[model samples]
Target: MDLINFWLENLPTMIDGLIVSLQVTGAALVVGIPLGLLLALGVQAKTKAVRFSSMAFVEIGRGAPALIMLQFAYFGLPQAGISLSSFAAAAVALAWTTSAYTSEIIRAGLEAVPHGQQEAAVAVGFTRIDALRFIIVPQGLRVAAPALLGFSILMLQATSLCFAIALPELLSQAYMIGTNTFQYLPILLFAGLLYASICVPATIAVSLLERSLSKHSA
Candidate 1:
C-alpha cells in the first residue's frame, strides 16, 4: 500500500519525464534515419572523398560509447562555442549514434537488393537518381524497417543515460524522487517497469512485423 501510494503520488512527474524521453527519442530517429540512409549510400559512393567521410562518421559514432557521446554533446560542445540545452544535446548525441549504427543495417538492406533491378531501371530509361529514389530506396527501407524498429526500442532505453546530463528524463525523475523519499529501490524498479512498458510492446510489434515481412518476401 505504501509503494502503491508512493507511485500514485509520483506518477504525474514520472509520466512527464517519460514524455520528454519519448520526444528526444522521436527527434533523434527523425533526424538519424534519413542521415543513416544517406550515410549508407555515401559510404558506397564511387567518389573517394564521399566514401571516406561517411566511413569516418560511421566509425566514430559506432566506436564511441553512448555515454561518452552524450557527455561530449552536453558538456564538451559548449567549450567549442556550441551551446545546446540538455534535451538538444541528448537528441544530437543519440541521433549521431543511431545514424552510425543504422547506416550499416540500411547498407546491408541496400546491398541485398538484386543488382539486376538497377540494371533494369537504367535499361528502362530511368535516370540513376530516379531509379534509386523510386525503387531502390523504397525496397531498402522496407527491408531495414524491422531492424530499425528494434533499434528504436534500444534507443528508448538508452534515453535513460540522459539522466547523467540532468535532462529530467524518466530515470532522472525517478532519481530525484528517490533522493526526496530515500526509497531508491522501489523508485528505480518503477522506472525500469516504465521502460519495459514501452520497450516490451515495441519489441513484440517489431517481431510480428518482421515475421510478416519475411513471409511476404518468402
Candidate 2:
C-alpha cells in the first residue's frame, strides 16, 4: 500500500522523464537513420577517400562502447571548448552510435538487391542516381525496415545510458527517487517495467513485420 502511494505520487514525474527518453530516442532515430543511409552509400562509393573515411567512422562508432561515447560527449567535449547540455550530449552520442550500427544494416540491405535490377534500370536508360532513387533505395530500405525497427528499440533502451550524464530520463528519474526514498528495488523494478512495456510490444511488431517482409519477398 505504501509502495502504491509512492507510485501514485511519483507517476507524473516518471511519465515526464519517460517522455524525455522517448523524445531523445525519436530525435536520434530521425537524424541517425538518414545519416546511416548516407554512410551506407559512402561505404560503397568508388572514391577511395570517401570509402576509407566512411569505413573509419563506421568502425570507430561500432567499436566504441555507447557508454564511452556518452561520457565523451558529456565530459570530454568541454575540455575542447565545446560544451553541451546533458540532453544534447546524450542525443548526439546515441545518434552517432545509431548511425554507425544502422549503416551496416542498411549496407547489407543495399547489397541484398540483385545486380540484375541495376542492369535492368541501366538498360532502361535510367541514370545511376535515378536507378538508386527509384529502384534500389526503396527496396533496400524496405528490406532493412525490420532490422532498423529492432535497432530503434535497442536505442530506446540505450537511453538509460544517459543517466550517467544526469539526463532526466526514466532510469535517472527512478534513481533519483530511490535516492530520496531508499526504495531502490521497487523503484528500479518499476522503471524496468516501464521500459519493458514499450519494448515488448515493439519486439512483437518487429517480428511480425519481419515475417511479413520475408513472405512478401518469397
Candidate 3:
C-alpha cells in the first residue's frame, strides 16, 4: 500500500520522464525504420560494393550493445570533436540498433513477396524502382507490420538503457527518485510496473494484429 501510494505520488514526474522516453523512441523509429528499409534494399543491390557496405553497417550496428553505443555517442565522441546531447545520443544509438535488427525483419518480408510479383510488375511495364515502390514495399510492409509493432514495444523498453547516459528517461527519473528518497527497492518496483503498464498493452495489441492479419491471409 505504501508502494502504491509512492507510485501515485510520483506518477506525474515519472510521466514527464516517460514522455522524454517516447520522444527518443519516436526519433529512433522515424529515422531507423526508413533506414532499415534502405538497408534491406541495399543488401539486395546489384553493386557488390553497396551490398557489402550495407552488410557491414548492419553487422556493426547489430554487433554492438546499445549501451556502448550510447556511451560512445555521448562520451567517446567528444574526444573526436563530436558531441551530442543526452537525448540526441540516446536517439542515435537506439536508431542504429533498431535499423540493424529491423533490416532483417523487413528483408524477410520483402523476400516473401513472390518472385512472380516482380515479374508481373515488369510485365506491366514497371521499372524495378516502380515495382518496389508501388507493389513490393507496400505489401512487404503490411506483412512486416506485426513484427515491427512488437519491435517498437521492445524499443520503448530499450529506452531504459538510456539511463546510463543520464537521459532523464523513465528509468533515469526513477533512479533519481530512488537516490533522493533512498528507497531504491520500492521506487524501482514502481518503475518496473510503469514499464509493464505500457509494454503489456502494446504486446496484446501486437498479438491481436497478428491474429487479424493471419485470418485475412488465410
Candidate 4:
C-alpha cells in the first residue's frame, strides 16, 4: 500500500526524531521528579516563606501553558542576556512544568498517608525528619508512582510542543517530511501512530502498576 511504502521510506528519519523525543522525556523526568519532591516538601514546610515561595512556583508553572514555557525558554530568555539552544530550552521548560505538576501529585500522595503512621513513628522516638524519611515519604511515593508514570506518558506526548521551537522531535520531523513531499496526511498519520506506539504501552503499564500497588497495599 501507498501508506506502508511512505512509512517505510521515512522510517529512519522518524526513528531519529523519536530517539530525541525519548531523550528529552527521560531528561525531564530525571531532573523534574526530584525537584517536585523537594517542592512538595517545601510547600509543607513550617516556614511561611518557604511554603509561599514553593506555592508561587507551582502556581506559575501550572498556570502557564507548556507552549508558552517552551517559547519563553527558547525566545524570551535571549532578551534577558541568557541564551540556550533549542534542545536545552525545551528540556528546561518541560522539566519545570513536570516539577510543578508532579509536586501537587506528590503532595497529595504524602497527605494520603495517615497521620497515625507519623504519630507511631514519633512515639518510637524517631525525629520528625526520620519519621518522614522512614515512614511517610516512602509509602507516599509508592502511592504516587502510578500517577507519576501516567504523567510521564503525558509529558512524552507533550514533547510534540517542542516542535514549535524547531526541535527535531517526532512531530517536527513529520512536518519537515510533509513539507518536502507535500504528503501531509500520510506523514501526519504515521507520526500519530508512532506516538501511539509508545503511549499506549506506557498507559497499559501504568494501569498494571496501579493494580499491583493496590493489591500490595490491600
TM-scores for every candidate against the unseen true structure: 0.97, 0.96, 0.96, 0.98
Candidate 2: worst-modelled 10 consecutive residues by lDDT: 209-218
Give the per-residue lDDT digits (tens) of candidate 3, residues 33-143. 999999999999999999999999999999999889899999998899988999999999999999998999999999988888899999999988999999999889878
Q: Over the stretch 72-113, how does candidate 2's per-residue lDDT look in tens digits? A: 999999999999999999989999999999999999999899
Off by over 4 Å in 1: none
Report the C-alpha displacement of residue 59, candidate 4, in angstroms: 0.4
Quality of model 3 by C-alpha lDDT: 0.92
lDDT by residue for model 1 (116-139), tens: 889988999999899999978888
lDDT of the candidates, in the order given = 0.94, 0.93, 0.92, 0.95
In the order shown, the candidates' Cα RMSDs to the true structure are: 1.0, 1.1, 1.2, 0.9
Number of the top candidate by lDDT?
Answer: 4
Candidate 4, residues 111-147: lDDT per residue as tens digits? 9998889889989999988998999999999999999
Off by over 4 Å in 3: none
How would you order the candidates by lDDT, starting with the best? Answer: 4, 1, 2, 3
Model 2 steric clash total: 0
lDDT at residue 174 of model 2 (Cα atoms): 94
lDDT of candidate 1 at residue 48, scale 0 to 100: 100
